[model samples]
Target: MSWSHLLGQRAALDYLRSAQKSGRAPHGYLFYGPAGVGKRTAAVALAQALLCHQPPEPGEACGACKSCRWIAARNGLLTNHPDLIPLLKNPETEKEKVLGDQEQIIPLDTVLDICARLSKSPMAGPKRVVVIPEAHRMCTGQAEAANAFLKTLEEPPPTSVVILTSSRPEALLETIVSRVQPVRFRRLSAEDIRAGLAQGNAKAQEDEIALAAALADGSLGRAKELLEGDLGRWRTAVMKALERAGPQACPGVGLALWALADAEGKRLFEEAEQKDDEPAADGEDEEGAEAEEEAAAKTESGWKRFVFRRLLDLCEVAFRDALVTAAGAGPDQLLQPDGAKLAQALAQRFGDEGCSRMLEALREAHFATRLYVRGDLVGRMLAGRMVSNLRRGP
Candidate 1:
């Protein structure tokens, strides 16, 4: 019952429970799965069980224990428990080692430091848990950082437990993968997402929860993000704008969407500023200020891309619905039944060929995102391509 809160991860829970009960828990565990599907949650839960003082069973932690409360007391990367270490390189904690999104390579020094700590005795309990989120990042630069950690992973201390979580296990080195116990976490179902949302967010309505679950593509994190950020309303507004635009609605609609995404991103940024609990670092010189400014710019760019991707997802679904409509499918068969009007118009104008071409254009735009292209330029280019494809057809 220690894992009662983890929805859609029964297999992983069962495996961990059995491992704990059998007293055969490995020194290292590789938690592999898609994003936002309770991998981190399970890591913390397992850590709690291992660190608990009075567990009813070997693998299960009492829900009301001191260790459980300490593990649950997490803020950002740091937890209240000293023995539970969450290794993630963020700008706030490790400014010198900050890799950001462009080159997120965990440096060799970080691994050495963790290995040194693990060599010592546990501070709080019998077991020391080290959770490394996005463990695949260590595989970058010809796996330089990964090779550094391989030594410790191969021969870990008896008191230490390393939990490596990665959505892309294929990116990890084979040597490292062979050492750890692999526990797979699959993507959550819609009902799982809905249930998770209902438990965490009390303000969410039934309709919003259902829609978020449907559109999240099995990502509980994204479902919560959609509802929390009200991106659904943003999508509704975009669909409404294209209602009576000129044939194709290319550059105009595209620019409008880019602007909307930008605005929403800024809104989220301000919300973060309001909730910014971390205090500013003192004695910042001119160079430090500039570096902070540069980091801020990168963060803003990330926000734009994130919101734009969500918008593109909605548009893609709408167009996909349009294709179904062109193929004589009714609204019931459409993925986005609420956007039936827009789908009907798009189907009537572009027919099947244009919609297919447009999806290709969307794919190009998505690829552009990966390349760190400006969101506005990508939007305009996508729209221009859509217009050309539509005109060529009819």
Candidate 2:
């Protein structure tokens, strides 16, 4: 839409506008921030302003111009706008068909394609804009692609602009990093997320929205997924398993956690499969089909990691609630206010020290998982240690 639509990025927007007004807009920009915090959206908006037939003001798109309309078409895919090139990992090649999954890598061929296109004159406007979403994905242990992209960044076309958006700037090459101006995007506040949810979907219940916002960790994208995925149910099940995790029930608790992971993994796989079954787009051919299959595999594998991470996050929240309750904090202080009673009971049973120990076990399990430990084994160990810790009085 317009710059106004991007929430929690006032500083970034202002900087861009100021640069535009001063005729000092950089040829290359690297927008780095937490995922789903509107980096891509802002990038597209900037492109629109740059390409607008009749921009209302410096750094502001009219949003109603033909160019703006074309940019907005297909949710900023900008396929028909020849002047704007979006060099994202093709949907058929992403680590997951969904966002917030594993890393999606940009292949060398894609980089070469952008280089070829940038060599041409703009078809629809005076300036051409190239956007590379998740630029960190360009690394992928591919020296050719990074080196090729580096050439363009070193001496970009005077009439064209390149914008790279990434959540993991550290993953990018130092050479590439030095060539682009950096625009930092911050995470959204809970209040801002809550407001965004209300604006996006007024029908959502206030309490549900509040819970999602609270658990979102400053990510509106995560908040939306929490609501859509009915994560509340999973959270309830996790809490119940924790409550029943006595020494005798430790195995059962582990099984429950495994079941939860399995169920989520299955659901994600089914979604990916369903997407794969859909008819190919207009120009898609055999190569596209192969790419889709590869992407689906990547998606399935990535979702496994995503599920494990989510379980860890839920565990952390539960233990934090217990810790707060043990400290006699008000119910309002609990992250999961819906589970206040359970948190209070847990605190009474395990005390603060036990909760702390359980949290430590979870952290260790998380670290081990990151270090390539078997997930199921880690879950079992965590379950066993949680039960043991809870039984060992303060």
What are the RMSD figures for all models against the true structure?
6.0, 5.3
Superposition error at 238 for model 2 (Å):
1.9
**Residues 144-215, model 1: lDDT tens digits:** 678878988988899999988777789999999999999998878999998988886799878778877887
lDDT of 2 by residue, 1-394 (tens): 5677687888998899999888888988999887767787788879888888787777878888778887666555545567887553443465222222233677786788777778778887767888787777778689899999999888788888888887779999999989999999988999988887888667777877887788778877777656655466667778888777565776677657766876786787777678769973432221111111122233554555456656777878888899999998988888877778788877876789988998898789768766757678877888777677764534
Instruction: List per-prediction Cα lDDT, in the order shown.
Output: 0.73, 0.73
The candidate maximizing lDDT is 2
The C-alpha TM-scores of every prediction are 0.84, 0.85
Off by over 4 Å in 1: 75-82, 86-103, 142-145, 245-248, 277-298, 391-394
